[model samples]
Target: MKITPELVEHVALLSRLELTEEQKAQFSRELSKIFEYVEQLGEVDVSGVEPTAHPLPQKNKFRPDEVVPGLANETALANAPETEDVYFKVPQVL
Candidate 1:
């Protein structure tokens, strides 16, 4: 598609941008080049290529879950500066 001054002005209005005449012209040229390159890319053949999320092989690197003994509540509460019943107490936050 051809990039025109009208298209640039429309885009500027949509994007809430206030481009000068020079800026509009510069952006029009740059955007036209980008669109041309994308159009060229669309002409390439890739019928046999497989679509992939990553270039390299990827696998979930999760560790195995195992049941383990946990610290007793009394032992955990022993080091606390403040405690209310079996739980630690802290200053109230707004």
Candidate 2:
């Protein structure tokens, strides 16, 4: 899992990135360190460990859904300059 300059170059090409030689060298070192840390993590024992999707616990709050009185049609359409039967009318586009 060692990240070399060639691997970094290939990955940069795949991601459509224009990286300089210095950037490629820096990324190679950083990515290699990350891979080494991940390899170390693979050595940890977790035979009876439970897999979790989230690190923290979560719960959903619930409330009753009910219909409430809303604005009248006349009051709703009062601000509009154009109104057909009981709805606002706008210019039609072809």
Candidate 3:
């Protein structure tokens, strides 16, 4: 699929983006190249390849989770510019 200015403009409108004329042209070219690459990928033969949800084996991929003591409240609040009652104090929001 060839990317055109009208297509780019339509996408921009849908995405609520304001693109300059040059940017629109650039995006059109870039999008066209991506589509061409996808077309090339479509030409490859993968008839004998097995379908997989992931490339690596799923079992034993991560280390076992261990319970660790968290930092004390006083240590966690040591570097606060503004704190009140063990909590960070920020400006009031309306």
Candidate 4:
């Protein structure tokens, strides 16, 4: 598609951008080139190729989930500068 000044202005407004005349001209030129490249790509043949999510094969490598013992409340609060009955005392946020 041709990248016209009107199109550029619409895009800028949608993106919440304020572009100068020079910047709009520059962006229009750059965007035109990108669209031309995409148009050129449309001419390439890929009849036999299968669409893929990734270019290379990938698999999740995860370790087995294991149960572990957790620290007791007293042990966890041992190093706190301020503590309540069994919990750390922190300032109210709101």
Candidate 5:
């Protein structure tokens, strides 16, 4: 889990970043700490816990769909700035 300056430079290159030597060294130290912490977390006991996609209960919040009468063509086109018969009129597209 060591984060060397070379590793930092490689990641910087992948991320399209231009880091100075000082920044690379700084990031190397910081990333090492982060990886070390993650490694430590991996040692904690979670054998009794069940795997879950989310920690909280989830439910679909939508109302049931019901057969409903659709708007009439005249009602739909009533507010349009421009219309041709029952259809909306717009500027011609190429």
Candidate 6:
């Protein structure tokens, strides 16, 4: 299908684009060519093709989950510039 100047104007309005007359003409030609290509694709017949999620098959590789002791509070808090009793302290924000 051919894209008319009116259609280009509408598209420009929808996209909030400020197109010069030259740009509008250029876009109209490009959009028409794209529409023609799509029209050609519409003529292809693919009746029973199965929809695929991915072109290539893949398997998830994961490590086994295990409970382990983490760093103690003293070690974890060693890098903090400020800490209260057992927790890091930060300036109060309102």
Best by lDDT: 5
lDDT for each residue of candidate 4 in 1-94, tens digit (9 for 90 to 100): 7798889999999999999999999999999988887898788899998989898999999997998889989999999999999989999969
Worst 10 residues of 6 by lDDT: 37-46
In terms of TM-score, how similar is model 4 to the real structure? 0.46
1-94, model 5: which lDDT tens digit per residue?
A: 9999999999999999999999999999999999988898788799998889988999979977998899999999999999998899999878
- What does candidate 3's lDDT look like per residue over 18-89, in tens digits? 999999999999999998888876778999989899988888568669988998888998998899998988
Can you tell me which runs of candidate 3 are displaced by over 4 Å? 44-94
RMSD, model 6, all Cα superposed?
A: 11.4
Q: Looking at model 3, which ten-residue stretch has the lowest summed lDDT? A: 55-64
Error of 6 at 93 (Å): 34
- What are the runs in model 2 whose C-alpha is more than 4 Å off? 13-16, 59-94
> 25-64 in candidate 6: lDDT tens per residue?
9999999999988898677787998878999888998987
lDDT of 4: 0.92
Quote the lDDT for 44 in model 3: 80
Q: RMSD to native for every prediction?
A: 12.5, 11.4, 6.7, 10.2, 10.9, 11.4
User: Higher-TM-score candidate among 5 and 6?
Assistant: 5
Q: Tell me which residue pairs clash in candidate 1.
A: none
The number of residue pairs in model 6 that clash at the backbone is: 0
TM-score of 3: 0.44
Query: Model 5 segments beyond 4 Å from truth?
Result: 44-94
